[model samples]
Target chain A: MIWLERLLAISAKEARQLARDRVTFGMIIGVPVLQMLLFGYAINFDVRDVDAAMLDQSRTSLSRQLVGDLQATQVLRVVREAGSERELRELMQRGNARVGIVIAPDLERRLFEGNRPAVQLLVDGSQPALEKIAQGLGSMPLLKRAGTSATGVRRFEIRTEYNPARRTAVQIVPALIGTILTMTMVIFTSGASVRERERGNLELLITTPVTRGQLLAGKLLPYVIIGLIQTTLILGVGRVLFGVPMAGSFVDLYLGALVFIAASLSLGLFISTIALTQFQAFQMAFVTMLPSILLSGFMFPFEGMPAFAQAIAQVLPLTHCNEIIRGITLRGATLADMHVPLLKLVIFLVLMFSLAVTRFRKRLD
Target chain B: MTVAISARGLTRRFGAVTAVDGIDLDVPRAQIYGFLGPNGSGKSTTIRMLCGLLVPSGGTVNVLGHEVPREVETVRRKIGYMTQRFSLWDDLTVTENLDFMCRIYGLDGATRRARMKDRIRSYDLASHANQRAGTLSGGERQRLALAAATLQEPQLLLLDEPTSAVDPQNRRDCWENLFALVAAGTTILVSTHYMDEAERCHRLAILDHGRIAAEGEPKQLARDIDATVIEIECADLTAVRRVLVTVPAIRSVAQLGNRLHVLMHRDSADPERELRASLAGQCADARVERVGATLEDVFVAATQLRRPDVERAA
Candidate 1:
């Protein structure tokens, strides 16, 4: 009878508290809608209608036909036709065209004589995603020529490297590392702190002989352990299912994660210091999450952005974090190569920790 | 006796608002000092500053043998503070929460475990040791918070409105625990709104608008009010209250269930004798009984006296 009464009492209290929070209830339902609409409208992996400029050194009928066939697929458009290579190179540099197709003057004779033809495709290497797209689109002409040569003489040979499968998951999983950590740290730590203050436990804690630093460490230590566990879980799944290789030392990865967790925990502490209510902390967490997820190279590639946008993205800890993770995992980058990003993370940790400690109220205000 | 807490012109300012105004206070060791005030009267603010959670803008606070905001960590280690709210893990069991506190305080091994077990048993919470704190009742949660704060042996215990949400029975239990702590040579400064609880303190400070309006023993403050309560029982007691309201000698008239208690400013007026003659013809069956004043009457008188001064200051 006692056990039954306890169970009923606990469930009843839980239900009552859950029912009282209309906003959190709404968010649980609304968040999926928001994510669906955002992903559905804005996220697309398939490249289409990329601009191109032509520099036809051989103004031959064959060259014109090849250009026309490439344009017909709509992956490349001839935005400009330059008379010289210098002009073509300038056009590419000016961002007018993503791809520059140059055909040699002897293109028609070389192809007719069953000689392997050469077409130089000048792609902007800086824009990796668009460069990949342009390269994928540029391969179509060569494939068609290979088919046309019945005597086993191909006009051109195309080679694709680095993400040949063009799988979006490869690019997304590395970025997801930052997103998952930020989400976990922000939600759990801030929520815990705010709830304590809201429920009057903060007062009890303050009055204790425990220093503010000790209290902060105590409050944050559990969340850090939880954050690391979540990181391991995410990385584990990525490895088992997606075959994400551990290129760098696992020690290095964990160290990087420790820095990230420290930075994120400091941010959470700072937010808790400023916020009076649990609802306000939730709002602040969301406000911080949007920028971290969107601008931190998690959902978008930082290399494709302009210099100013890159500078803005640099301020986010996730930007450096993604670079560190991806470079180490994919490129097998050593500590020397990962030093700059690691340095940035260390600096972020220092700044966040210092600010949180300085502003934290040790006494009741 | 050495002072456990000593503050001189202590003040705390939050931007434009002064939460704790300039005030001087001293709490000797092993004494139960009660800070009695309504909500937003700076009791919590004063407690925080004394505990080194906040730095006073313009005052020196020496609590438990160290200056505040400088030796905060040392002082904090010697003080146990229980805030106005329950702050423990809702998902963790009682034993787990206590164990976590021990770890945070850097306590370990058999000592931490044995002491925690003893605390649970002493608090009558052994039956629910495995139960989550969130699943406990309000009174039980208070007990948990109390137990967590006291696990470490601190010289001073700062309780901020500890019994605000507790039931009357639990509030009584909390007071008993506090008194036990005092008996064990721990100085206590507890903030509370309940007068009955305040009356139990060694001495009480009545805080109003970030300043102490009065500070003395409950009986002493009541004596300072110099008011005697006269209980009047008459036919249609409503008529007696109405008559007393118009009389200048009668400071206030309140209904305590059926009988009317008339508060008189001076005994020279002899409210009982005067009221008896006035109501003799209207109701010959009227009886007047004089009674001792209570802390509630003192609180009322103190607040009433300060209103005009507060208006002028405003």
Candidate 2:
């Protein structure tokens, strides 16, 4: 009972202090809303409106029909017309167009023989994402669908699931839950201990009968609530503004988020123990935040990363949280289905909390 | 008298430099004991060691009958410590700060409210109870710090320079409050550089360069000073001081307004006649007389006499 009383004393004090700090209080609400708007609207992976240059040598009605079909796909727009092959190359070189379409001079004869290629597609190889779109353009049955009917065999059928429309907001909004929680939670608790030392409060506090465990636990209590509030805010905005679907239960999402919040807070407290000043604590928090954002599969595909990078990403709490959130919100997966990532989050919380408690000493020296 | 704190051969070293070197102390119970020294004389370090806020590199400390750093938890429950700086939460109100301290000390709700009310009344903080601590004046802040430290009615209070930032009027009021606490049978160990504050202590220790040069009752130490005190009044006190320093027996010279107070070795049988002889030609109208030693004279003799280079530099 006494231990609980002492722990609550510190927690109450911290909550009061946080309420008095205007900038920090503002950040609790402001950071989530601002970041939700920024990441949701700015990041787009559905590539469209690529500029292309066309060089039609046949001068026949069939070549004109091919151009119209390419435009109908909405992937490439013929922004410029070239007189010859050399002129098409110049358009790509000058950065005026990212894709080039060339029609053979004997297009009708080649189609009749079914031996030589009737059309050539030249794409700029500098931008990888745009180049992939251009490759997709090359495989479309433009000549066959344009009425020639040369090749009619279909090899395989592909289907898109979960987000069938493939909207980028749908992908980024759920991941924003992990990103926003990681940023705010880690930064809030990272400066707790260092701020006490800098302001000369640690000397007085340590001399009392309070234990190290009580101190750390009390400091982390308020920030945990703040993290949950931020998670709810992001989810609400994503659902209303971006039309992101939440197919899973809210209880399951909150349960997973609670563990991730504790893990991030423990990591901050661990940083607080090692850093000597508030500035140093902030710098160290940022260092951890960069990796969580970049390597946590929040912005890039996890499978696309190198082996060593994936190995490192496995250690970060954000990576597992992103998987858990995305699984629940988009795939309608239950906690039982994503037990692996949830278990990893609990392990991370235990490891970081133990390290923080061990590193923090009660004495000044 | 019973001993409240007993330290022996207390040593602390920070790499190559020793902050506190082999200090031996026994502070009596229910008395105002003081550590009188200049800045960096290890006053704060010794206080921290006693409270177990710092680990002594080499000695043993027994505070309030509990061994320190080993039985530190037992000691912490019985004693209250105030740091050199105002370490209370600046953003919290005075009442809130006291309430927090009370809860940390594990007082019940009824007892917590009673203690907060009593502290607010006694420390004259009723008017500022709702104001944030950061907005309080220096004197009010010091009073609040004292009230917070004593919220649990600790048996022994360790205060490190508790009145350094207050004005003289507030300082006198602070000492009066300390005396009141002592009257209530609480032992206080305070460290200070002010001579007047040191003189008020029942017992005192003079620390210099990480060592205790002298320790005893303030008046008793002054009575037993090893140097002879002489006061000289003249038209030009500076010229008399210049002439007096050349005398091999004189250890230190200090000017007090129009008079030059001189300390000579005790072996000088006729210090007054010797000083007159030294100042005969330069300031023949000077009056030289032997005087009783004050606490400042005792402090100077204890700390500055043995280090002649320091004396010369001064």
Maximum-DockQ candidate: 2
Q: Residue-wise lDDT of candidate 2 within B190-247, one digit each (tens)?
A: 9999999999999999998889999999989999998999889999887887787689
Model 1 docking grade: acceptable
User: By summed lDDT, which 10 consecutive residues of candidate 2 chain B come out lowest?
Assistant: B304-313
The residue pairs that clash in candidate 1, if any, are: A200-B85, A203-B83, A204-B83, A207-B81, A208-B81, A209-B76, A362-B53, A363-B53, A363-B54
Considering every candidate listed, which one attains the maximal lDDT?
2
Give the i-RMS of model 2 in Å. 0.7
For every model in order, the fraction of real contacts preserved is 0.53, 0.95
Give every collision pair in model 2: none
TM (chain A) per model: 0.63, 0.95
* Residue A258's lDDT in candidate 1: 77
Candidate 2, residues A168-190, lDDT tens digits: the string is: 89999999999999889888898
> What do the candidate models score in CA lDDT, each in turn?
0.75, 0.91
Q: Which window of 10 residues has the lowest lDDT sum in candidate 1 chain A?
A: A2-11
